[model samples]
Target: MKKIISWAIIIYVLYCIGMAWYLFSFADSSIPAEWKGTTADPATFLTPREQVLSEQYSQWKNFLFFVSVPYDWLAYLAVLWLGVAKALQTWSEKATKSFVVQAAFYVFWLSIIMSVLTLPFDFISYRISRAYGVSTQSVFSWMRDETTDFLVNTVMLFLLVVVLYGLIRRFEKRWWLYAWMVSVPFTIFFMFIQPVVIDPLYNNFYPLKDKVLEAKILALAEKADIPSDHVFEVNMSEKTNALNAYVTGIGSHARIVLWDTTLQRLQEKEVLFIMAHEMGHYVMKHVYWGVASYIVLTFAGLFVAGRVMNWLIRRWGEYFHLHKISALASLPLFLLVISVLNFSVSPVVNMVSRYEEHAADEYAIKLTKDADAAISSFQKLTKEGLNQVNPPIIVKIFRYTHPSILERIVFLERIKRGD
Candidate 1:
């Protein structure tokens, strides 16, 4: 029975991988030209100086996309973890017999090494952003932010590993089930705390502080039926020239946050349009839906990983110095499997996200009744952010969380025409 179940899982994994490839290779990039009717082309919308910078930024981003898998999956996680696991095992051998303590120790060392290994890529990306006039932070400030991120992630990684390994030891066959169950609350807790706790570590967030604009936003929030006590402005201009506004957290924690750069770059109407879009996300319950989707994906990935890890350990246990799936040393192998599975599903996951974003765009237009503001906002953001208006289908399917700016503007124009 166990053999049959394992084989069935292997087949399902192969099927999912194949489906992912098909989605990436064959997804359509072009929407109906009717939707794009009479809208200004984003490709040629920028000033000459801005165009040059935009091209450079796009090229840098494209380069990063190509190397992401190799750097993150191959070098940082797989190959690094192989040797790191053995070294950690040696270090932890005499230090403790408690599994949770030993797992935490291994996680701490792995987190540090992973951060170091990935720092060069991160540095280069920051340099490119600065060269293109997108980033405003000094090197010292950037390093400080990076250090904070590393520490936060390290602590989270330690807790997760301890709980994960504990589950593995307690229930050999059903560890994945227990882990998935815990992740429901675990994920929500992070979401709930992120606005109040994690965000302040990097940037200061203050009430919008513009009385007239705040009143306008509050009015719009009332129209949308969302909470309106406060809208936040993040100190993003201190770090980047990009424009953004988002709604995050849940219940009392949920509120609007706009980047200071957004305030500087966009007009009042445009900012209101952006806020309306965020309100769309809130009213539509994208946050809750996103969490539910995560739970489903996490459950599926964990189940598959659990099944395959058992078989993998049997075959290559001694070679990797892993005696069992529950062993701390086996973490790298399990991570490698889960990473591959997650990458495979990225296109499908992103497809759903794009749909939600499109829905938000439609909702914003409906609620605001200001098609012009919505169109202007998308164009300004596309130009300022160096967005590729017409990227290849594969890139859109695999990478885009929002619909392309061109697609969005086109859609709003259609709505304007009563299409």
Candidate 2:
């Protein structure tokens, strides 16, 4: 078991190094020739005030993001090494009757502690956003949202842990496969219910009230063969000054959602471009594809986690006061493996996401024949969201789920030129 884990760790480390090599070796620096006479630098297109704000916002988020990676690793490690998980398991065993109920209690306790540990980072992020004029949410309102989020996450985590541990106990060898099978339907159920059952808890949503705008958006949706019945507007301005729109949910619950801030801030043409892009998401079945990709990754991740977990239990189980891989006390170790696996595969996952975004951009341009609108909309989003146009290559590859604004703009110009 020690030998197997050693090999796995070596291979995983090598894969990450290879990805880093590829990322750095091919770091992009080119911009379109047309950009030379105009604003060559994406930030220059913003107002002087906006440029300063964009840099500050981008730097703060990037620093927080990178810092949190190591912080999360240490937090999970602390819970395991400090016997926090063991303590929770002991308490749950004494406090509960049903094994499943005990699992729930353990999950709740661990989740609450982890949330508290991460609150300082979250609070700092909120304050930074507020300072930069992005977040409009008050600290009290943010805390309320965080509390609601915590409860929802705890319930979901409790259910997942109970099911996973049950599988580990019963199947022993093939539990990873069973867990992956269960996740498919579980994920679908959440996607179907989120818009109706969960989202409204955080913010208000209603059918878009603008008849003229609704008519235009519905026309675009029809062209993409997406549902044209209703476009939902979320009251996001109360929480954020950032402008955006997206497609969410699945099947009957599937709907287009516009941040109210987007409508208030962007032009009608820009809004149409944004709507078209989101409709492209539905038409292209990006959500289903995303889910499929996630399931595949989760299958591999769980398999690796199971393998590494067994080795770890054999190697240091007694030292950590962990009895078995299936024991509730092993939850922290399970999380640590999963986190490492997730971080290792993030660049690949993010590449797929960026591809989807680029495809959607193309679809929007092709459908609207409004390349000008699309380009301007990208610029508007860059300024409004305070996005970095050309963030550091390492940061872009690891952290960005969508292509940088500069990349999108250059791509758009190429498409416009038929290049």
Candidate 3:
């Protein structure tokens, strides 16, 4: 017991050290002064009031960044520490003789407990977004969304848990390999269906309504040689005023979506640039590469988890209230390792994402040949999103999937200048 508690404390201490390290790393990280031009600097993108709001929003986002990872780690830890994991396992067994039912039962309760434990961090984020005039959701509506989210997550988790534990029972030594083998297809299927199945549960999606704009976007797609019928738009203005557009799904299911907020706020040219950027993802086969990356990360993560789970159980099985790594009670420990692993690898993932986004941006500019439109579109994005033009290095590494707004706009500004 003492050993387990000691290790937990040690892990948390190391997490604290990592948080500090990220801050220090950000301090040392710097971008080129030349990127900040005399006429069209990133800082010049925001007005005085917007600068204040952006700074405030950045501070809150950074605070969330520091706590969110730890919150996930501690949720798993709390379940294990408080005996909820063992209790839930026992209850699931007592409730059903069937293995599938037991898996579903256990996963459902475990997910709920973790959600309840971690709800505050998410609630804080919502409240922060609301306070900043970024979220239009009411408290009840927000809670409904949260509930819908966890229920969906629980169902997906139940499926994965059944496969994982079933593999463990059948081939204890090679369960990780088998589980990952299953996951590659499972992940692809999920990605393929998400735009059609899971996404619609949250918001309405339909063809972009404006015929003139849709025709222009389809022309842009044809110019890029992207096979598409029509542009899709989601009712984002119903939720928030933030502007966003992206490519989702894979292959035939693949389509570009623009937010109605974006369409309403930007000019026709700016909107086309946004759609062109999304088309670039399809043109470059980023979805396939992204899936490949996810599969590789899962393979490595599962392998490490298998090794670590066995070591911990071997050393302190009794302390953990479990006799073997395959026991359902050991799940929290397994997930704890995975949570830490994912957090540790996130910077590398985000780095790749930033690169992809940059490539897409370049593709969009080339296809549109409208650097002025691209620059102004980004500036508008920065304003509506309350995005800090020059965020610290820590944010650049962990939170940002796209290059910073300042970086994108400045790059396009250079293109406009022929520099």
Candidate 4:
């Protein structure tokens, strides 16, 4: 029975891979005639070496996409099935009489094991980035970032588990409802603090040094009615060569951040378009909508996951050492179920994200009246990131949160023609 199930899963993984390849292999080769002599044409701008490098990087990214989730599922299953989780449960319980302490201990050990499992792939990804000149971070700095990321994520998970299990013990059947209620405020709090507390941990940030450019960006914000604030910049050149800017945080905590790399790489006009695009996100209320969508999804997912977890515990409690839904051993089962649910909604999330990003592009163009700068900025961004002009359909569906550079550039050109 187990063999049959394993074979079925293997077959399904292959089917999905095949479908992704099918979608990618048929990439739209047709470029509109108007874009022929422009930077919008990949061939016009990309050197032969750049084209080869981008293609190679794209393939590596797609390979990782194919393997990442299945690898995670397998890693978690191994910990569960090989009795590591059960042993941790036993040890954590023996270590403390406090249920909360046990939960924390279990979470810590589970995170360590998961990190170990993920490290090889993570290192592979890092090494590949270095090879492609995408990341300039030193090995020590990269390792430091990884450790900090793991610790931060583990602490968050531990807190969430404490809340989840405490509610389960108290409410039992209605735990999901309470969890959702708790999560809404918790999510907002995290976002509010992230830009202030969490962001500074990874990189140094300060007020933008270019006073003249800062004035322009601030004026643009005023025009957009997003409230005036200081524009900030982060030291990004220490880690990567990628150029990016975004509006992060909520309420008074909100600020626009530019990667120092962006300032160095782009012209002043191009930088304005990028910053204007980030402001568009605020003007369009993408952040609020995103938070609302996450809240809605979690409510439904939690209810469904609770049902699935309860069913699994009822059926195979003793077999898997999961005698109760609240048992520390069952965290893996809960996570596995929740992960599957997340995958189910991944496309919808990406779809909304893409729409918001495309809207932001148009908004930036209209606000700045610099279709040329937007086009050039996007083209430079693609080159810096080594992103393909147009990814495969499957990649677009699963990975892209913004319209393809090809589409974005073409749209800008169309508007330029009308102008």
Candidate 5:
């Protein structure tokens, strides 16, 4: 039994190492050649607009240096892992209950510690938004929002981990099915609570103010055959400089949340264009596809984690101070798995999202007949949000969800020229 367990542990460790190496190698190899130019390159092909966005990225990078406090806090979880391992090694074989209790306690303790670490970045991000005149939330308001987020996330995390651990132990071979079943309820719970419970905690929402705009939007919905009531505006300007719009919720509760900043900053035609874009996501069923993809990826991650954990527990369980099951120790491994999956498959995800966005852009043009407005809207939003105007192809593949501003502008230009 001991030999079998030892070999399982060895094989699992090697698998993890190999997986990590493959991910890193792919990322390195995939970096686009265009982004390799030095910061000092004067002859760079960056347009004046691109130069300005790049400068903002530089400033944000500097601000990020002060944000290392959170990373340090996350590191403490590893330290806790070591401590738990020591404790488990010293425990008697007969004390299984005590071992499990200790392991659970450590998981909870690390979770609390990581949450505290995350607070600084959360506060800093909000502060920067406020400083930039993008957000209107006061420190007190920010704290309230953070507390609510923490509570919601904590509940979700606990439920997910508890169910996941049980699935791994009881139905190791059928863990994927168990996980998919769990996600059904989880998805329903999120859908029910997000609009009602979660979103209202951060921003104010009111029925769309302009009757003409509301009618136009509703008319467009009718044309698209999407059953939705009045369009809604979210006071998103109170939170960040970022400009975004989305269609969320289902049935009667379903409504579009247009950011106040987007409305104020963009022309009426431009705003409609943005709405058309969001509607395209719904029309194309991109959201459903995304959710399905996540379900499959999550199951894959759990299967890998189970195999790895079983091997680790059998061989080094005693040596590492892990008695029953240590969710905390397994977390880093789980994250690594998810990260690799996301990075490797990012191009496919981006391509799908970009396709939906393009469809929306086309829809907007069709409705408004203002391709010029669409182009200007893209430029203004990108500038205001400090988005890269001309990121390299490599960056687009790995990082960007939507196509670059230049690409969109060119596409619209072609549409205009054809007319």
Candidate 6:
């Protein structure tokens, strides 16, 4: 068991290194030419929007701001390793009865430590957003957001740890089956409660008012054959300047949410394109498939984790200052398992999501022949969000959930050319 765990750890670490290398290599080679633009001066590259945002939050103090990016990255990696190691050690012991008790302690302690470590960057990000007129919240508001996030995360962590430990204890041989059984209920519960219960605590949501716009949106849904009852608008502008639209829930519970920021800035045609794109997700049944994929991946992860957890506990348990096999101590093991799964399958997942996005974009273009409107909307979105127009292929494969702006523009241009 000890040998198995050591091998697993070594293999996992090697896999992570390999993934990082692959990502960096791809970024260097596959970055699109159109996305790379030269500036007459370095300052010419800084968009007015970026400048305003930077100036606004410049007052916020960041202790770690002085640290180089590479150092920050190393610090993050170290924290993740420590947290995971501590968690796995606690979970591998036979003495622990209640994973919840263990996980709570682990989450509480780790969150505080991580929060302190991340404070400088967090404050800088908040201040930057505020400076750009993208964020409405004051410092108090930022603190409140953090507090709420901490509480929610703690609860979720406790639940997940308890459930995972229970599965490993009872169904060690069939951990994957147990995990799948647990996930179905949890996913359904999350879907049902998230919009009405969880979201309301974070941001205000008022029913959309424009009767003309409402009718137009509803008509698009009807044309797409999506139920009218599922169409809704949210006043997300109060929270952030970012624009977004998403399709949530499944079947009867499925609904659409469009941010007020999207509506406020975009023309009617642009809004329609966005709506059509989201509706495409629902129409294509991507949400159901995505959840199903997660369940499969979760099961695979638990099976892999179960195979090597005992050995890890025996070897690294003392080093991480942990005793027993509880959920709390086993977090690092869990994270390592998850990271392996992600590293191995991320490109496949990205391919799936990108395909859906492209399909949605196609649907949007079909609904509105306003290629110019689509192009302008994408430009506005990328600019407002301070997104890179073109990112390295490795970054896209590893990090991006959506295609880059340049890719979207190229696709749209291709559609225009009937190629």
Which candidate gets the maximum TM-score versus the true structure? 4
Q: C-alpha displacement of 166 in model 5, angstroms?
A: 2.6
TM-score of each: 0.88, 0.90, 0.92, 0.93, 0.74, 0.76
lDDT of 6 by residue, 289-386 (tens): 88888877777766666665666667665654445444355564455555556667888888888888888888888877778788778866755565
If ranked by lDDT, best first, what sequence of candidates would result? 4, 3, 2, 1, 6, 5
For all candidates, the clash counts are 0, 0, 0, 0, 3, 20
Candidate 4, 115: how far from true, in Å? 0.4
Give per-residue CA lDDT, model 5, range 107-180, as digits (tens). Answer: 45545656675667666776665665546777887888877876776666666656766676677577657877
* Residue-level lDDT tens digits of model 3 in 1-419: 56666787788778766765555443432336876544345456666787778777866777677867886887776677667888988998899899899988889888878888888889899888888888787898788889889989899888888889999999989999999999999999999998999989888999989988888888888888877563689998877878999888986788788999999999999998888899999899998999999999999999999998898778756556777877788888988999889888999999999999999999999899998888889888878888777678777888889998767877887787788
Worst 10 residues of 4 by lDDT: 22-31
* Top candidate, metric lDDT: 4
lDDT of 1 by residue, 225-283 (tens): 87676479888888887899887887788878999888888898898889888888999
For candidate 1, what is the TM-score? 0.88
Model 4 lDDT per residue over 1-419, tens place? 36744874797688667755654464553356876778688778789799878877887867676677777777776677677889999999999999989989999999999999989989999999999999999999999999999999999999999999899889988999999999999999988888889999899999888888888888888899877654689999999988898878887888788999999999989999999999899888788888889999999999999999889778866556677887778888888888889887888899999899999998998899998899889988988989888777767877888888998988898898895
TM-score-based ranking: 4, 3, 2, 1, 6, 5
Candidate 2 vs 6: which has more lDDT: 2
Candidate 2 local lDDT, 260-346, one digit each (tens): 988988888989999988888888989889877888888899999999999988888865678688889898889888988998999
Distance from true location, Cα of 125 in model 1, Å: 1.1
CA lDDT, every prediction?
0.77, 0.83, 0.83, 0.86, 0.62, 0.66
Residue 394 error, candidate 6, Å: 2.3
lDDT score, candidate 6: 0.66
Residue 299: error of model 2 in Å? 1.1
